[model samples]
Target: MSNNTNQAASDLQRNELPAKKPKKSKTLQQSDKKLPFLLLTPTFILLAAVTIFPILYALYVSVMNFDTFGNSSGFAGLKNYMDIFASSTFWNAIFITLLYTALAVSIEIFLGFNLALMVSKDGKAMTYLRWLLIIPMMLSPLVVAVVYLLMMNTDMGILNYMLQSIGLPKINFLGEPTTAFLSLIFVDVWQWMPMCFLIILAGLQALPRDPFEAAEIDGASKFQVVRFVTLPMLKPIIVVALVIRTMDALRTFDQVFVLTQGGPGRATETISFLMYRASMKNSDFGFASAGLFIVLIITIIISTMLIRFMNRSQSA
Candidate 1:
């Protein structure tokens, strides 16, 4: 009886000693979302410092009238903008850029969409073709330019020789204005269309099969199925593709620079190429900075609109 009493006393003492406190939950309640925002503050600060500051600084510099020799500098207050508006050279460059953008994008979309559809079809042949199609995108843009330039050379070009062999006239590919433009367009299309094709193909492959099977049971024709089902589902992916490709195309420099150098009276000179000439070749930093700022604004506006549109479509 004494031993039992001593054991009970010990148990009571141990229980009374203390219980370890419980740890606080690491995760906050869903309502307490502000913690995440607090954690992200540094990222926001860094982005503003790097991106926002430069953009604002460029805009400030554009309004100033400066020259290459660093003389005749003063606050012009939109005079540079006004000059850009008045210059026929600027207008012509804008026109050609728009034309190139439109043609390249349209062709890329159509051909890429079709190629993606074909490749995603269930077959061994398509699988092999898809692998092969990715080769162009794997090559460097500079290497592509060099190879195309060689192929487009008027005197020693394989393309010209092939045409001549077929009893056709040897056309000056990179020399004349029209042919120069066409050559550049072809090279760009060849290089980038594969990328679009791959993107769309990935989107197509990721789609759930139920909608398609259900549509088939509902007696939907091929065109009707693609129109009502596939296109709607692929919208988000297509928007992503558009954003990436447009940004790249707008800043097109390597191919045009290597192939033509804006020759034949600036026939193939894009805005990017023009800015390079101004900043690097002519050493006109202030003017080039202004032009680059304009390009940046246009890019931002376009990207914002596209992202908003895509968000709305996705939500709907």
Candidate 2:
């Protein structure tokens, strides 16, 4: 009888163990819900401090007259903004920035597409060359500036040496204002075109095989299929790439800063470089902040429009 009772008690204990699992799982589920937020907390706080706080502070500074001497001459209202708008230098910088952005991005997109086409073929050599092309995009703008400057310098640079070897005159690339602007555009294209190539290549590779197969069966030529089907399908990716490259081009500074310092007489001066000079060199924080705010607003508006366009294309 005692052995029978022991066996019955052991069976009851085993049944109760299963019942306890619900309570344990409830605790785990609660922890799972909190885990993502807990993990994200530090990143959110850091971004708030670094990005959000600075932007807000700049807004406040934009409203007041702030000199680097820590002298806050009360509120200047929109005077700083008005002054910036009235300045020819500001307008010229804006023009230069737009022109540089357009030239660099357009040329890069065209060249990158061709490069992507070349490397899209299946082969070991082409695959290796694709990665080699990517190396330029991975380099920092400052490093690129230094390297290009060394190579393109008028007197004793390798490029001029090559020119002389070919019975051509040495060009003053960074000295003449026009050539300086063109040189900056060239460097930008060389560095960023790889990005456009990679994106377009990915889009090309992911295109639906069935559509191409159908087109081939329908006796559509390669160029016709690309024009009607592939390009339409690729519109969204192209837009995204162009928008990203355009924004980055607008923010050009480091390479230009090191290479020309906005010279051969402000030829390569961009909007970003203008703000940097105003804040750091001229010590006019208020004016700089106003200019920065204008840039921020324009960027926000343009980004919104581009994003909307991308969304529409994706949906279609």
Candidate 3:
């Protein structure tokens, strides 16, 4: 009876003992699952430290009549915002930005769409063409601006020489207000159209070939096939390209800054340009903060609406 009791107790103890853990590699793999998050924590902290802090600080400063040195001389409440609304310069900047964005994005979409279609139809030829297309995009925007500025110079520009050679009279590309704004628009389109083309081309390539093949078999005209099959399938890509291009064009600063410097009587000065002037040139920290927040809010709202509209279109 004592032996039986001892044997039963031993069995129970063995049952209660934990199973041997997995080998070291397995143990390490389980540990590694948590390591990615641990690693990401530092990045998250850094982003919050750099980005979030400045944004919050800007909001706080916008309510105050702070001077250039960030010295809080007085509280302005909504006075800064009210003044911003009352300023005609602000309205002009807004209008110009909208106009530039509209024109640039429109031209980019049209040209990019055509370029993407042509590239998609080509075979080995497209490989070289694609690289060529990407060169403008790869070049720094500042570099592009400088190159175009030299080309568009009223006096010694090669562009004018070429136009004169072609029996076209040379017009002031950057010296006149209307021509300057149009020149800025043209430069923007030239620089950014490649990106739009690449994006749309990728989408075109991703499409299954069966629908087009079927249309071909059914004796569908090329136009009919494109209208029915290609356009519908490519809608999402088109929308994405439009949104991205629009956003970039709206905040257009680098090209305009380097090339025109918002010159010809502030004709090309965008909201971003105005913000830069307020913050850097004039050193009105409070007003700059308010303007920045306003721009940020507008961007968020526009992006949100675009996303929602795209989602609905995709679902439909």
**lDDT of every predicted structure (CA atoms):** 0.82, 0.88, 0.88
Give a tens-digit lDDT track for model 2, residues 120-209: 766775678677888999999999999999999998799899999999998998999999999999999989998998898888888778
- Please write out the lDDT profile of model 1 over residues 183-205, one tens digit for every residue: 88899899889889889988999
Against the true structure, candidate 2 reaches a TM-score of 0.86
Candidate 3 C-alpha lDDT tens digits along 1-316:
9999999987776677675333456789988999999999999999999989999999888999977676789788998899888888888898999899989998998899888888797877678878898899888889999999899987899999999999999989998999999999899888889888889899999999999999999999988987899989999989989888887888899987887778888898999888898888888988889888888888899889888878876786
Write down the TM-score of every candidate: 0.81, 0.86, 0.87
CA-only RMSD, every prediction? 7.2, 5.8, 4.3
User: Which residue pairs collide in model 1, if any?
Assistant: none
Clashes of each: 0, 0, 0
What local lDDT does model 2 show for residue 82? 96
